[model samples]
Structures are given as structure tokens and as C-alpha cells.
Target: MNLLSFWIAHRADMLGAIAQHLTLTLVATIAAIAIAVPLGIVATRRPRLGTALLTFANIAQTVPSLAMFGFLVALPLLGGVGARSALLVLILYALLPIMRNTVAGIQGIDRAARDAGVALGMTPQQLLLQVELPLAMPTMVAGVRVAAVVGVGAATIAAAIGAGGLGDYIFRGLSMTEPTLILAGAVPAALLALAVDASLGWLERAMTPGAARSRRVTTRAMTVGGVVLLLIVMGGYAVSGRWGSRVIVGSKNFSEQVILGELLAQVIERTTDLSVERRLNLGGTFISDQALQSGAIDAYVEYTGTALTAIFHQPVLRDHVDVLERVTAAYAATGRAVLSPLGFNNTFAILIRAADAQRLNLTTISDAAPHTPGWKAAFGYEFLEREDGYKGLVRTYGLRFAGTPHVMDLTLSYRALAGGSVDLIAGEATSGLIKGLDLYMLEDDRRYFPPYHAIPVVRTETLAAHPELRTAIERLAGRISEEAMRQMNYDVDVSRRDVTVVAREFLDTVLQSP
Candidate 1:
């Protein structure tokens, strides 16, 4: 009932997600059909070309979906952040099935039927249109069915890049740790895929040779379906910005990031006339950075040390003010203005199960280092790969476990340790899940990690366009203390409260204060 009530209350968002999802699937599948059918036909005539085509399709089909999205985000004119890039990735995935089926369908035609057409004084084009296409129609439609269903599932990931779909709710749900939101997005998408499969399957059956009279009817319906989908894509593409009001804001995919993203949006809403368009739960720091740099979003919160080292590739600085100064300057050089710190330092912490800490009398990294050979450990992908992350920490502490550090999502790592799936993890200092789940943070005795004060990174152009933003952001300066942020993260991650409500309540209290 909680999920149902929430769904009903936010039916507008749910409906919009469905529309965006349908549009992405329809557009990609239709565009795939337009390209694939011709290529499939030509490949049937050219033996060598057919081999090369299949090889290329197979290679493209094998590239991971997230990697493909990242690849496209770097391409010029044709790609960036949004539906265009997502459409291209979806079309690439849709191609192999559609093309392979088209070639198979055409080549699978009976030789006797072709001979009859030739004997009946039919031209090559006439034979192809009358005999070949009709016979191949059913199989080709099967390909379309597969591609459409695949596109629907893949479209959910598109939300990671700011392309609105059922995925937006799914990612948001994961960040908030709310199963209700997940179902709100996922259940609709699954049903949509089944609906597409059934509808296309019916059409494929209707195109059989015995149903000649209904052939044109089904084909016309197919064309109409494509046109309807294209219209939906255009009509709603600009509207329904998933709680957006313009001035797009984005954030990395995690509880803290989502709350901060909403914090910025709500602050903008309260201080300025321009409505904020949020694109939160992005894949990670890189995706959020790419979106901001590409102008897909106007602003997002970034960590000072992360910007200094991870993004700028500069060496780490231990002093908090020094790291902030260097990060702000580096961002300014790249046309991004880094604002005042939000008054929280979320440096990485080596965490252990509280039980283990108590049993082993572990109070610091050095104390836990001796027993590491018996314990399993894990870290987030960013941590494992970063200059300030796992590699450096291990070298600094010489802490060796029984095996190598397992890579896991930052948020999930907390629960994994608590649940005894792993004995150790690198977690954020301010993560609410730490206290909520009874996990213990070992002291960073080596001080290997740098200060990671949170600050808003906004485009210089966006600031100039909306001068009011400077003051609005300044309102947040030195505002969110470490304790306040931890409690808010706990409210969402542990208490399971809505992020928007938490951000709004915080803002209400902040504005009412002297």
C-alpha cells in the first residue's frame, strides 16, 4: 500500500517515465528497422559483404552497454549527454538482431517459389516485392520483436546519462534505498517489454501467406505505430523533465550525492525564478563531470580533493583549505566555478564490521593491519582505481588481506560488510549507512586520504546567464555541517525518507534561522 499510494501520488512522474521509455524504444527500433532492412537486403546479394556485416554487428553487440554510452558521450555533433547519445547506443544494439533476421528471412525463401516467379515473367524487383518480401515478412517481424524488447530493457540504463526513462526512478530508488521507487520504474518497463513482444508477435503471425488480405492492414498498422511513437518522442521530449524546472543539475549515483543534488535544486527553486531541472543518480564522478563539461547540466556538487586529484590529475594536498583553493583554481581554468564548501569532509574511511572491531580491539588502520591476512576486503571501483584510493592506502599501510580487494559499489559495500559477505570495505566517512547498519570506521592512522570538502561546481556561462545563482549558492556556504549531512544521509539511507522532503525540510529550517 505504501508503494501504491506513493505511485498514485506521483502518477504524473510515473506516467512521464513510461512515455519517455516508450519514445526511446520506438524511435530506436524504428530507426534500426529503417537502416537494417536495406543493409540486410544488400548483404543477401553480396556474399563477402554479408560476412563483414555480421562480424561488425557481432562486435558491436558484444560491447558492454555502459561502456558504449561512455564512448558516445565523447563523440562530436552526433553525441553528447541525452537522448541522441542514448538513441545511438540503443540503435547499435538493435541492429544485430534486425539485420541478422532480415538476411536469414530473405535467404531462407524457397528456391521453388523463386523459380516460379522467374518462370512467370517477373522482373527481379517484382519477384522481390511479390514473392521474397511476403515470404520473409514473418521472420523479419520476429527480429523486430526481439529488437524492441531489447531496447526497452536497455533504455532503463539511459537514465544514468540524463535520458529520462523508467530508469530514472530505478536509479533514484537505489540511491534512496527505497524498493517502492524501484518497482514504480521497473514493473512498468517489464510490462512494456512484454506488451511490445506480444503485439509484434501477433503482427508477425498475421503476415503469413494464408493471411494475404490482412497483410496490407497489418503493414499499415505497423507504419502507423512507428509514426505515433515518433510523435510522442517529439511532443514530450521538451516537457516532463522529471521534477525539472530548467537549469539542469546532476549528481553522482549515491545517497549523499542524490541528497546534495536535490539540495542544489531546492536552493535554486527557493532563491531564483528559474526552475531547476535535476538529472541525479548519474553513473559516477566521470559521467557527472562529462555532463557538466558538455553543458548537459548547469551545475552539480563535486568534492574538492576529487576535483584536485582524480579529475585534474594533480597530486593530493593534505590541508583542507589548500585542496579547496587548488580545486577552485583548476576548475576556474576549465570554465567551471567552484563555490564555497558545504562544510562537510567526506574522505574515504577503511571500515570494518563492528563485531570484528570489538573482538580484535581494532581502533585504527595499523591495529587492523596485522589481522588483515585472515579477513576479506572490498572497495568501490573509484577507490580501487583512484590515486587517493585503495592502491595508495595499501602501499601506505602495507595492509594485505588473504586476497585482493574486491571491487563493489560504494553504497552496497557498507551492507556487504555488515552482512558478513566481506570483512572490510572503503566507505565514505559521512555515510549514514555506517551507524545505521552498525558498521565501524577504523581510524585513518596513516592519513593517506586527503580532505574531500563538498562544493558546487557550476559552469561559468550558467552563472553569468543567471547572476542570481551566485547568491543562491552562497546561501549554502558553510551551511551543511558534517553532523547535519550525516543525519540527512541517515534520514534517507536508514530512515528511508524521501530525499526531496529531507532537502526541503532542511531548507525550511535554514531559511527560518537567524
Candidate 2:
């Protein structure tokens, strides 16, 4: 489907996503401005303090927004999963621009104006409120405007953490390889950014002294337009909830996640008589989990490794059964239940081009690490920075190579390895596609990586109300062997078959037959 048709068909979701995106960006920007403005005023008086504050803000800006989200999600006080964590990360991202601008605006004000205020019997506070602030308003507002746009853009990544936004469509599109779905998200997000930037610009200009009243009126009109657009988005979501009969399901953006979510939705509809609507391809594991918690989705597939490391902050494990049991127990305490595992472990496996492996006689991650120093190593975005990711492993093994490393998505890493562009890829799953590409997984003789079993996870509340749901889902769990997962992934990722169709067939074969 084209972008226009996809928007029309899924307008309600698009609208809801936009609402979420705006709400997150606005709240973060407003908070950032409130905090930064005061700090900016303080810094204007104490230039040294301003330097210290700016340094911290700049450092914060270097931290990846997603990594910040993950760090916040693990914190006990400010983190609780879903939009809360996403919001915290957005706020952090907004701080530098807003804070820096506030300081700059205050310091940039004509010094003579402040002297005039003091001569006119004004106190420091009075001078700041009457002279410096008003004169500096335009610059400060510009900073806020920049922060707002950056917040909105960064908030799209929040979708990866379960903060629903226009990014949902884009990530879903990416997973499903549907360009139209991607545009459904990208177009609205870009438009929203523009709309917000324009409105803020007008507000800034309107506040300036000697600015024409006609310009102020035009600015007012732009603000009104933005408000109306926001209202329309909210109204669309309300209408969708009232009239839409579909149960919108979603999945993380990956082959296995899409397959499992599609399978579960199909089973739920066929076996429980519930209407089903699929919204698969929703980004990463944390994003999928957050979506379910926020009621953006009913459920999605997750792995024991992700739950333990990314979600729970536990140490990695090598024993499959032990990891599964620990993860199931931990998640259960949070009122979430893990349906039986799919008997297959898709743990992170390091893979090399057949030619490279043969040339170097590399047989494990450690062995590959030495050659990696001299050869380019490619990894997924997360794997490159994660503490337990490639860098950690490389350090642990004390291996050095000669080439610079690059990071890309997991799928892209596979292609790069096959095309002889990368010497090694750190995290690959045991699937047919890698095999088909003439690559081989090196044995981790030391078993450094954690066990990652495919499993169906559902909210405990859902299972409590419908006990039979567990059985229906578990029937498919552990039933899908390694070979089966490989074939299914091949069908969707390599052969280009529809995921829903493949899921339906698999469900019928497993659940319907005697």
C-alpha cells in the first residue's frame, strides 16, 4: 500500500500516535524551559557556574537517547516502564539546547540596558524581570523552539522503549519491509515538527518590542492552526475507539517477533472468538513490552536474555533452562506471565563470512577477536554500545584488531558479512538465512553469551481473566524447533511471504489438528 492509503486505512492509529508524540515532546520541552530559564539567569550572574552547567548538559547530549531511556527504565525512583522512562530520556535530550540558549540569551542582552535599570532604582531582581528577560525573550524562545523540534525527533526513538509515537508506523514499516508504512509515520512526524517550529517562531516574534501588531495576529493564527490540528488528532482517536471493531495487535520489529505475535493473534481470534487486528513490526523488545503495558498492544514475543539484561538488569547466563526459569519468575512478580518457550534458543551468535572463517581458521568469538583488531567488525546499533555487547566481549577476551568498527542494524550486518564488507558480526541468530548466505556460527566454547529462548509473554491480568489463553499460546511454544523457526524466518525474510498467512497456517497445523 502507498503512504496515503496506509494513512487512510490506519488513520486512527496514526492520530493516536501523533497525540502521544506531541504530548511527550511538549511536556519535556515545557519542563526543560522552566528548569533551564532559572538556571540560565543564575549562570548570567556567575559565569563559572554557567560553564559547569553547560558542561553537564553537553555531556548528557552525548549519551544516546535510547541508552538514556534504558538507563532510566532501570532506575527505581524515576523509572517504571512505558512513557515515564521515555519522557525522562526526552527531557534529558532537550536540556542542552534549552539550557545553553537560556544562558546565551541572558548574557547576550545589551549590558547598557541593565545599567539603565539599575540607575532607575531597580533591584537586581527587578532589573532581570523588567529589562534582561524581556530583551532576551526572543533568543530564549528560539532555544525553546529548537529544543521542541529536537524533542519531537528524539521522541520517535521513544517508540523503541514503548512510548507510542509516529515512530510506531516507521518501525513497523521497517520490520515488515513496507515503505508505505514507514511514510505513514515519517510524514506526520516531519509535519508535526514543522508545525511546532512555526508556531513557536510566531510566539517569539510576537513577544518582541516594536514588532508589528499584524505579525502578532499572524502568529496567533498559526498557533490556532496547530491547536486545531492537535484537536483533530485527539478526536480521531476517540472516534476510532468508539467505532473500530478491530483489536490492534503489535510486535517488535524483527522476523521472530512478527511471526510470534501474528501467530498469537491468529490463535486468539480463532480459538477465543475475538476479533483481531494486527499492528506488527513495532521496533525493539523494550518498545514492544512498553506498548503492551500502555495498552497500545495486547502482547508481543520477547526473549529471556532481553528480559534479564535489558529489562531486569540481571547478569547474563549460559544455561538455557536456568535463564528461562529466572526470567519467567522475575517477570511473573510484575504481574506478567511467560507462556511456554518455543523450545528454540536464538541466542546471540557471532558469524563470519565462510571465506574469512576458512582463511583464519577462526572457531569462536575469542579467536575472531584477535583478527578483529586488523579487520573491520560490524555490529547492530545496540550491540555496539551495550555494556554486555561487543565491546565488553572484546575487552573480556583481550583481543585486538587493526580496523575501525562500524554499527548497523542486525539485518544489515548479515548482508555486510555476506558481501565481504565486515570481518565479523557480533550478534546473529541461528537461522537459515545466515546459513543460506554461506556463513557459519563460531562455537562459543566458553559460553559467554546468555541463553535467549523464544517465549510468549502476556500480562497476568489477561491470563487471570482467560486461563484458556495460556494453553492456546503454550501449544505453539516449544513446538517450534530450531529448524521450524529457521524455515518460518526464511519464508518471511528471504522468500517474501506474508507473515500473517504463514502464522495462520502454522496455527492451524498446530492447534486445529488432532
> Which one wins on lDDT?
1
Candidate 1 lDDT at 431 equals 89
Give TM-scores for every candidate, taking all chains together and pairing residue i with residue i.
0.93, 0.72
lDDT score of residue 426 within candidate 2: 70
Clashing residue pairs, candidate 2? 342-478, 343-478, 372-401, 373-400, 373-401, 373-402, 374-401, 374-402
Backbone-clash count (model 2):
8
- Give Cα distance to truth, residue 194, candidate 2, Å: 2.7
Can you give the lDDT of residue 112 in candidate 1? 99
Top-scoring candidate (TM-score): 1
The local distance difference test score of each candidate is: 0.88, 0.75
Q: Write model 2 residue lDDT over 1-514, tens digit each, in one string.
A: 4567667766666677777788889889888888888888878789899889889888989998767876765576677456788777778778888888778878888778888898999998898888888888888889899999999899887776556778766776676455666788888899989988988897888877788795669767967876886787677556535244445466776777778778888777777645555556556665567656655565667878878888788887777788888998998887788888878888888888888788888777777765666777787766775555776677677766556677777776777888888777875474656766788888876777787788787887767666777776777766777777888887876776656678877777788556
Model 1 residue 13 lDDT score: 61
Q: Provide the global lDDT of candidate 2 against the true structure.
A: 0.75
